[model samples]
Target: MSQSTHLPRTSLAALTLGAIGVVYGDIGTSPLYAFREALAQSAADGISRGEILGVLSLALWALILVVTLKYVLFLSRMDNNGEGGVLSLMALASRATGARWLLVLIFGATGAALFYGDAIITPALSVLSAVEGMRTIPGLEGMGEHTILITTTLVLVGLFALQPRGTASVAGLFGPVCLVWFAALAGLGLWHISRDPGVLAAFNPAWCLDFMESHGVTGLFVLGAVFLTVTGAEALIADMGHFGRQPIQLGWLVLVWPALTLNYLGQGALALHHLAVSEAHHQLMGNEDWFFLMAPDALRAPLVVLATLATIIASQAVITGAFSLSHQAIALGLLPRMTIRQTSAAQVGQIYMPAVNWGVLAGVIALVFGFRSSSSMAAAYGIAVTGTMVVTTCLSFIIAWKYWKWEPVWAALLIAPFLCLDLFFFGANILRVTEGGWVPLLVAAMVGTVIYTWLRGRRVSLERAREQGVAMADLAAALAVRPPVIVEGTAVFLTQDPEVAPSALLHNLKHNKALHRCSILLKVETVNTPWVDPAERVKLEVLDERFTRVRLRYGYMDKVDLPSDLARHPGPQGGGLLSAKGGTSFFVGRSAIRFARKPLLPRWMTVLYMFLHRNAADPTAYFAIPPNRVVELGSQIEL
Candidate 1:
């Protein structure tokens, strides 16, 4: 179902390699800290052989059911015109059910907002964990927490600063280098496993059940840590548009899955081997830094370097994902338009959002300084990831039943097992609220509230504005008989409603007492799909030869260049009325909004909406209009 599935074999292989570098970066780095955290979490249960084996089993099955099956196989197919993300999925599902499903809209928006919290935490936690590997080095035992903290803060700052420059030059290396990282994971696990093959029995589900039975209620707490192994699953789905479907699936099944599985198994084996040989197994029970501890002293420093690089790569993936999500939000009208800068001429997906970049930077820095270490920050990570997965499951069920046209019973039956697994992960993470998990939840709640309020307030504002507008036909007929002083040059008025006269046009007529020979009203429309055909993009209607109305339709992913698109059609009635050589001015109306005496939106929302509106990007920049040839008309609206 990937758009590029029909590509030549060689090209497909190349994309598969590229997909490994970007898509797998987050989940791939998990072996560095995920296994250690899971081991440490088992301390609540009192360490035993059964508990170790059970934890490993739970991690393996999570990868199988959640990532491999749910995301790679099921959700990947739910693309919106070869694009995939929470917003795209929401658009697809909502189209099938129409305006009746309010639940779908709320869940879709919440899932998107939750992603912002994860974006902030990922860079801080990942860099801190990798830099903490300095603790495992010889003679650096006294280097302490302050040293790691400073080092991580510096790296994160530099990474964010470089975002404006784009990633195309060095992006090619991400693939070849990650290949080595996975190979190292696989090789390390194989070495330790050769020492004691008995730990390999964790591949069996029976071991997971045995460990659960041994630990009882405490074992459920381990699910929170075990959940980290698959956090990258959501990132992979969001990045599906960059590399397409088949490439991601091939990379995961072939390289990523086996490497991660082997590394986790290797850590388990090393822990068991240490527990059996040392008499002080109690001190070493849950303190299995066995991931780095498995290697020789000579290789430890090099592994740290490799890990630091990988985590940086992982951090990059999430930051880029944040940019993409923010762009989608602007297109869907969940937020006011922000400045979107295209960083690459060759690749359209390489974009940079200034607000998103700095906002995430602020959050990450606060998290690093506040949490102090990766172990502490790790408590905040899994809840957001699990919460998103649960939301995805519910949304996907709607897609299956409504869009894909499956029987309701069959769809629910198929998705029920995955939903149950997601709920268990969410519940396990609920226990972490006291242990610093409240950070992401609080951030998500604040963000989600703002987005919902902005959307609702905008809707009510539009309804009130529309009621004051006069129909274009009536205005056109009135002007034909009364005819204002006709001038020589051309004038263009931009409006939201094509059926009604633009406020800018009305204001110009009232003040100037003159009209251009060619007066055109142009309205921009955003389509529900990803890309609109250029042939069907611009529609021109005739209202007498001198006055015309043109409609430009664009998909959410499409960019509008009013100057360029109009260049193709010269004269009146789809012909170029506006000249490339002469005096032509674009008239835009700027609204000065005032809250109504009895507001439709909540009082708090009205304040936030006004603030966002004042700070949003200027229309002159967003529509790519030539600033030199623009005129502004001001109007006051009460909503």
Candidate 2:
């Protein structure tokens, strides 16, 4: 038998737009409340207006340095075969440093797990902030703050309920609407800024420095605010594969960033002019009459409707992010595979995981209900976002120096400032633990421990099975003596390693020694991007008179291609005998772990891994194999 190869073509434009619509939504929506919290902390400390403007300046610089410079300009280039995410970065790192791979893997997986926390918080706060504008609604006037909170929570719940349907269907409307939403935010803010041009001074870096110095330690406490500007910015790098490098870059540079900056500036201008507004009013109509205040009284009703739509898109982005983030986690072995539901057939980009959708929905609702307002949610929001950003910055440095092959000094020079900003935000957000920041950190810690345990336990179980299983020679000798019955036609064994002979080959020969006319070791390698080439479909090798090894390479971004297509895989040796038409794929399923462990991890962590693994997507489905063609040889080992 012989091997083959192929190439996948993709559109950079479509992917970039999709990235903007999906990836940037969480961070894009942050301007809604970032300034309010910053200003609130400033006021509490008796800081002058200059100090508030200074904080805004720091946030603006953070966005530029961390997001545009670090991610868009530098980190995006480190994509692993068109796959952009923490795991891909780790994979790239491993390729660069042959021996130190573990170091990168641990950091990447930890970063990915942290992202799950960000996913949950983004929606909770974005919706609460947007819906709080209902107080400005004429007929909705005097609506209790609690009432607004409950309504927002309910709305978020309903939005999540639509997850199984997939966002692709509705996203067409989302992108255009969000485009309008950002424009409206900028327009409204500018209208107010036009009313008073003093807000233009907020752009000066001096204000940010002076403000922090003036407030002393209190300035650090407000990091929870500075952290908001770039909360979802990681998504830009994480989902870079979706749109490729150009569109996301263009979207941020031309559309997303400008709109966001204008809005932020507008908000600052509004806050300065309306110095006497109560905290409640400020929360409702911050800095530039809150973007909603821009609409004429006659248009306020429609504007409320538009703001809700924008918030919905923002929430949708987080939900989609949870899907993408979980996928990366599962691939990295940080998470067990879940029932990943393909939401859109046309757009392979659109997907839904029921477990993640519901899990995140529950988390978001809990946060909203518990905090009752975006301000409190703000405290919880920054820590995870900034922490993840810091990780991203650190990883980006590795990516730049190794993968992108940039000079060490240059990479450090470029990344150091962003790292400092991220660290500053992380330090500032530390105060939020008592207020709200503890939520994401706690979530990240719990998730990271469970993932670590499951992966570790799984490694042990595989080794145990390998040791216990019978060898191939023994099975062949047994079959020669007494021929056993064949259960499935030409049983196909899928192995992680294509070069090495499969353990199943040895186990089967020893256990039943049943000789089939044909048997194959099917190895499928999922590559980085979504599509696969037909020419590279299957690589076949004949090992012995009865044994054969077939390696199938697939891009991670590619769909789970059907093995039936194997017949069409034309190689030098006629594509081998196991062409998918007549063979049954038998997969050995391994399950493991002990619930009680006193020496290493806490007992609670062991329990969590057991629970998470139990609910993971079953091996058969996850591999995209037909149920009837699969067999689970379940086994367990000590962790």
All models: lDDT? 0.85, 0.70
Among all candidates shown, the one with the greatest lDDT? 1
* Model 1 global lDDT (CA atoms, 0 to 1): 0.85
Best by TM-score: 1
- Tell me each candidate's TM-score: 0.96, 0.87
Per-residue lDDT over 1-639 for candidate 1, one digit per residue giving the tens place of the 0 to 100 score: 256678789988998999999999999998877877877887753467777788889999889999999998888888888888788787777777884798888877889888888999888988898888888888776777888889999999999999999888778988988999999999999999899899889989998788778776667778888998998898667877778888888999999999999999999998887777653644544465677887788898999999889888999999999998888888777878898888889988888889999999999999998999888889899988888888888989999999899999999999999999999899999899989899999989988987887788778777777888888889889989899998877788998777888888899989998888888799887766777788788788888856788888777677767777776665554446567234788999888778779777777777888888878898888889899989999987776
Q: Candidate 2 lDDT (Cα, whole model)?
A: 0.70
Give Cα distance to truth, residue 74, candidate 2, Å.
2.5
Query: How many residue pairs clash per model?
Result: 5, 19
RMSD of 2: 5.0
Per-residue lDDT of candidate 2, residues 408-428 (tens digit)? 999899889878877877888
In candidate 1, which residue pairs get closer than 3 Å at backbone N, Cα or C atoms, i.e. clash? Answer: 570-575, 570-576, 571-575, 571-576, 571-577
